[model samples]
Target: MSGLLQGIRIVELASWTYVPSAGAALSDWGAEVVKIEDTRGGDPCRYLTIGGLDPAQSRVDANFMMELGNHGKRSIGVDIKSERGRDILRRLIERADVFLTNWLPAALERADLSVERIREFNPNVIVARGSGQGSRGPERDRGGFDAASYLARGAVAYALTPPDAEYPVTQTPAFGDLQGGITLAGGIAAALFHRATTGHAPVVDSSLLSQGVWAMAPDIAAADYYGIDRIPVGNAGTAPNPAVNRYRTRDGRWIQLVFLQADRYWKGFCERIGRPDMATDERFVPLANLVANKETATAELRHTFAERDLADWQKILADEPGVWATLASPKEVLSDPQVVANGYLMTVTDAAGREYRTAAAPVQFDETPPPPRRAPEYGEHTEDILLELGFDWDAIIAAKEAGAVL
Candidate 1:
């Protein structure tokens, strides 16, 4: 594979999308990632059928959620409650360069997989922990979900919802979780570099709440200093500058114009729409008057935009513009020329020989991405990994019989 992290090995002991997505990212960069799951059921995300399909109706192919976060990783199921299973984990960690987990401190202690204990096996390993809130405080042990900790507690949900709306809008699937995972991956990469240079094993910690706050730092920072609340501007027409709003064309397509400095392109904009006289009109003469009389300006602009279809408007305003773009949906983005040219999406083949489009990692190397590997099945590499760890066939059989390693 043509990737930057070809020689790195990561031992991941986390479940669900949040942490697993990080492993997927590492795998994208060519790291050898081994996912450790419980023998009982493995990760619950594997069976998730959120889009109206029952688990029993699923096929032997990759599920949507599983493919999104678990691609390019090997899985090994083991009962960490047993001493033999714990030893197996220790051996993996000892041979790995990085150890990642999402289990809380208490859970890690109970399983004897704490960072301190992990260092006993590999002193130079980077210990990375992903959490819901943080590792400290009274609610440290409390379980944290993306919706509760990241979206609600971190003020994302409140900030995005309109003040007059009856209910908060639902966020995109695993929105916060994916961002947190990316943050954790960057932290782990930095820690690995630090350890390589200084010979000091680093403990990297990342939280969903922290990532959420950071994402909305501009609003949160303003609130802290000026006591201002985040008020969602539901209708762009309500904005003081009507020019910086969305307008619908005759074909029902929208063009969002963000003309912060409206005066700069006033004459050109009026000329582009075949309304040069409107530029000199007394009511719309100066920018100050336009702001004061935004409702009238919005009405006039809406009427002007509605006179033509989106394609006609695009051709008319090809050269005359401050800042504008066609409003695009997610499906439209998939076929966008820029997105395609930049290689933002990739095609992958599943176990059932079905090809599907999947997103590539955010960054690229040599102007292209590595071809993705399919996600491994449950315990797909358990026996092979045990054998590589110096276990004989009989020893592996004994461990499997004891319900330690699967």
Candidate 2:
């Protein structure tokens, strides 16, 4: 079967995680994505890395950029600041179904690449823009990263660290950016579907702050009902329940135990852990009592759990009633059997012929599956694309000489 977005074309005039990630998802679903990069440095992410590297190696590799948001897409280097570059982009947009970007409103206005300009060029094109905040917000002009977005809009400051800790560390993995990307992709897809049906394009705008609001909805809703504000509970949840916290195993691996309905599972849990008396104790009988005696209950549970390793606990609780637990770690999750069984990991080759394994797209459709394609080399498709755009070889070379493309 053909992919969901088989005939759709996307022109990505974006950099970094937010907009590129959305384009990548569209590419995975089989849209033809052409990533437009500046002729000089290319995307800024190409230079981002974990450790210092040799210049030669870094330029050839560009590992960080390829890994995050360039998968399943083609790259074209063009100096969009030039008139020829602008003409090239306009030509591409004329044939594109979607134009995705993350430039701020001012930057878009400065570049003359706003949705209005895109619509003037191609009225049937869906314009998707990702921003730090809403376009009309007071802080819209302010720059934001995952950390700032999480702290400001997500209320992450309240529960991001231990209560008594002096400093709170931001979560890595660009949480807000990724969430915003996913949301933007969803909106773009919806808009594309709508356009397909109605023959009218729509603007899809998303923000890191909007994504954060969705992430913290549960806590925010709880805050409205209760007079108390939510605070960091460390490894514990905000459920006001003791059975839903982390427990230390014998080998020091932390296991998360989450039994919200303690009344249904507490007796079985205690019996399984060889603590029958605690199960019948009035102080531990009801949910309120268990929550009230959280400290004592947690200590007892910890002591009981420490008698066995994580594997042992897994075996003991394999089919037990109401006791759901699992060991947590990034490595463990990556190698998990369920993930592998579900085909949540895929392998792709980079420009240098190096094979890199990465996570696959999460969404699934019975008739349309995501395609796996390598991220393109810098300006790898420049000549071919220009030729497709009706530029002859001599014209292409002259354009290159004119610094219209790199």
TM-score of each: 0.91, 0.91
Please write out the lDDT profile of model 1 over residues 1-406, one tens digit for every residue. 4477888999998888888888888888888999998999898887776765675665445676777788888899988889889889889988999998889989988877777788899888898888998888887777787888899988888777765677986787788988998888888888888888989888888888898899888789888888888743644245668888889999999998888888898878988888887788777768898888888888889999999999998898888758999999888988999988877777678666877666766777788676767778888999988998899999999999999988
Model 1, TM vs. native = 0.91
**lDDT of each residue in 1-406, candidate 2, tens digit only:** 3278889999998887877888877777778999999998888777666445555664334465455587788889999889999999999999999988878888889999877888889989998888877788687777677677755667765655566667765665555676677778889999988998989898888888778778878778778878567732644323357688877789988777779788999998888878999999888989889988877887788888888988998888888877575866867877789776766666666567776566555666673446556677778899888888898989888889999997
Alpha-carbon runs more than 4 Å astray in model 2:
51-65, 224-239, 321-323, 350-354, 367-369
lDDT of 1: 0.84
What does candidate 2 score on TM?
0.91
Clashes of each: 0, 0
